[model samples]
Target: MNVLEIRNLTKKFGDFIAVDNMNLSVREGEIFGFLGANGAGKSTTINMISSLLRITKGEIELLGRNIVKESKFAKMNIGIVPQDLAIYEEMSAYENVSFFAGLYGLRGSLLKERTVEALDFVGLGDKHKALPKSFSGGMKRRLNIACAIAHRPKLIIMDEPTVGIDPQSRNYILNSVRMLNRMGCSIIYTSHYMEEVEEICTRIAIVDHGKIIAEGTKEQLKSIITDTKEIWIGVKKEDALDLEALKRISGIISVRLEEQTIKIVSKAEINNLNWIIQQLIKDQVEISSVEEQAPNLETVFLTLTGRNLRD
Candidate 1:
């Protein structure tokens, strides 16, 4: 079942259109990756979904109810962890969670119980009494998450939830994302970190120039660029490589000699490996190893959008 459905969703800023006729859906139990470079309408779309901005046109449905018309119902079912920390610095960890949970209409013993549960889930149970000002970057990030989940919303939208944290903390949050999905919450996860999205997302959609340019699983997205393949060739002599001649070879799109390895992007259907090796041998380049590089999510993003995720 789809927990969220966006049909012809459009948002504008006077003369500028932020999101243009966007159509998307997030299935229940999916950690859906929503990716776009800066100023690509990604944040604008998210804001509209969270009801932070008024839509200029189209409908956004959260669990079958229109976000604009039935905002109360939508808000109750959706949890948002903004890219910017939404917790109060002076507030104790417990108070922070409780406050956000209370906004969802949780009260009395139920609010306190859910607050503590969220704290424990994020590994900040012992720090419940401590203020967020004293917490580490990762802990604060986790606390931000704790606040969002305290209300136990059916759908969670996490915007850059793992940014600027240590590897351990990032891993912790990634694991927590998976656990949340296991517990029956559909997630809309956006991150500049390609590997994070690649690692955890069940399906992904890439937006560029205010429109979705690609949408699919990692492998499925990679398949869109089936015309090209990347190959890494290890050589004993880097100086002996002929970069220009390699590019001139049939089916080879581009070539680069990096240190002791020659990187080549070529036509996927071309049988030019032997030809490349022969040309390299002619240049007195001794082959050490040859490996074909599989296209990853980052590759797909760059190929489709013509820009890096962080660009």
Candidate 2:
């Protein structure tokens, strides 16, 4: 079943269109990875879907209800964990989760039970009375998650839930996402950490300039760069090579210098390594080693959006 549907979704800030006309459908019981660079329309789209921001144009359906018109109903079925910490510093862990759960119409005995379940699920049951001000970065992130999931919404939108936390905390949150999905909650997960997305997402959609540039499984996305073998060459730090001239070579799609290393991104089927070597020798460049490499998600992101670093 499609848990969420977005058709022609767009958001604009006066003359600047943050999110162009976009469409996407997320399936039930799947971890959907939403990836993009800073100001790439990722947050804009997310805000619209969560009904936190008004859409200039487009349609969003969550669990069979229109989110714009039926805002309250649709929101009751959705949970949002913002990138910033939403928990209060003075509140105890139990108080934090209970407080957020109460805002969702949960109350009395039920709210109390759900709070305990959420805290325990996040491995913070033992620290229920501890204030968030005393928690570590990872623990605080976990508490942020516990608060978001206390309502057991059908779909959870997590934005950089593991940012700035230790690896152990990151792993715990990733596992918690999987656990939620197993319990029948669909997830929209966004992170700058590509490997975490690759590890957990059943499907992925990458956005740029407010449009979905690519959507598919990890292997499917990598297939877009067919027969593209990255060639790496190491040379002396003082070696001077003509970058523009190298880029002009046939089958050499891109050439750039990373420190003392010259990296060439080219198609393996048509790239002539021998000719490249000949040109290098003529240029009086000392060669250390030449290696062929396969493309990964990072390379694909750089190829599409030109921003490899996650914001």
Candidate 3:
């Protein structure tokens, strides 16, 4: 079942259209990555879905209910962990969780149990008494997540939950998210970190200039580009010849010599490297080291948009 659906959703700020005719659907128990560069309408899309910002035109349905007409009901089942830390510095971890849970109408023994569960889930069970001000950047990020999930919402939307945290904390949060999805929570994960999305997302949608340019699983998206494998060979000596022959190889598209290094671009289906090595051996061309470059999310982004994701 699709837990969330956005149809022709749009949001504008005067003359600037933050989101344009956006349409997406997220299935239950799946970690869907909403990917984009900075100011590419990721936050704007999240805001509309969370009901924190008004939609200029279009519809959003959560759990089969229209968000605009049934916002209270829709929002009640969704938890939002904003990019910025939303906890109070003066409050302890326990207090912060309790405060946010209370806003969602959780109380008594149930609230206490949920608070402890959330704290433990984020690896902050031992730091329950620590104040936000005293915690490290990672600890604070964990606390922010704990507060958001204390109410046990059915859907969780995280906007760069691991931003600015140490490697340890980032791993902790990522694991927590995977665990939550395993326990039956649908998640909308947005991040500028391509590797993070590639690591965790079941599927991803790449948005740019207020539109979705690509959407699919990692392998599916990578298939959009024909040349998935790149080979680079380092020549032992600049005097070594056969560079022209390498470029003319059946599957080889282009070959360039930079000093003693030979860069080769070829069709992914062809084992061009092996073929190149064989030809070089026949020509007695000196070779140093050979390496294959596998296609990644960054490469896919560049191929489709003609620009880097970080740009």
Candidate 4:
């Protein structure tokens, strides 16, 4: 079943369309990875889904109710963790989480219980009395998550929740996301870290220029590029390599020279590594090492958008 549904969802500012006619459905219990380059309309679309921004034209349904019309009913079932820290530095961890819980209509003893649970869920239970001002970067990021999950919303939207944090904290956040999904809360996870997304996400969607360019499992997305491979060759003399001649190879797609490294992309199914080596040998290029780069989520992103995921 789809926990969240968006149809023809669009948002426009004057003549510029921040989000085009977007359509998506997130199945229940999925850690949906939402990815895009900077200014790709990902934030705008998510803001509209959370009802923080009004949609120019479209429908957003949480569970089965229209979010814009039945906002109170829908918002109660949604939690948002913004990219920036959304906690009070002066307030203790418990009070900060309690405050957000109150916004979702949690109250009294139930609110306190849930607050404690959230704090512990993010591994900050002992630090409940500590002010956020004294916490490390990763702890602060985890606290931001604890604040969002205190109310136990059915759907949690996390925007770059692990950015600029230590690996330990990053692993904690990623594991917490898995725990939430296992406990039945759907998540919308956005990040520039391809490896994390590739490791944790059940499915992914790539957005660019206000539109979705690719959406599927990692294997399905990779199928879009067909069977492609990248080979990296290190030569004793970088100046002696003939890049133009290499580009003319039967299955060679492109050739690039990065310092002493000659990066060659080719159609994997048809290309011959031995033939490539023979060419280098034929050209009198001193080959020091030959390495084949594996195709991965990062490669898929670069193929679809013609730019790096971080770009």
State which candidate has the highest lDDT: 1
- Encode model 4's per-residue lDDT on 26-103: one tens digit a residue: 999999999999989999989998889998998999998899889998899999999999999999999999998998
Q: Among these predicted structures, which one has the highest TM-score?
A: 2
Please state every model's RMSD to the true fold in angstroms.
3.4, 2.7, 5.5, 3.4
Candidate 2 or 4, higher TM-score?
A: 2
Worst 10 contiguous positions by lDDT, candidate 1: 298-307
| TM-scores of the models, in the order given | 0.86, 0.89, 0.82, 0.87
Candidate 2 residue-wise lDDT, 104-221, digit = tens: 9999999999999999999999999999999999999999999999999999999999999998999999999999999999999999999998899999999999999999989999
Runs in model 4 with CA error above 4 Å? 233-288
> What digit string (tens of lDDT, one per residue) describes model 1 on residues 104-213?
99999999999999999999999999999999999999999999998899999999999889999999999999999999999999999999999999999999988999
Error of 2 at 77 (Å): 1.2
Whole-model Cα lDDT of every candidate shown, in order:
0.91, 0.89, 0.87, 0.90
What digit string (tens of lDDT, one per residue) describes model 3 on residues 1-311? 89999999989999999999999999999999988888889899999989999999999999999988998888788999999999999999999999899888888999999999999998899999989899999999999999989888889999999999899889989999999999899999988789998999999999988999899999999888756566778877546577788777878765667677776667778776777888788777788988886777866776666555566
Per-residue error for 61 in candidate 4, Å, reads 0.8
RMSD of 3: 5.5
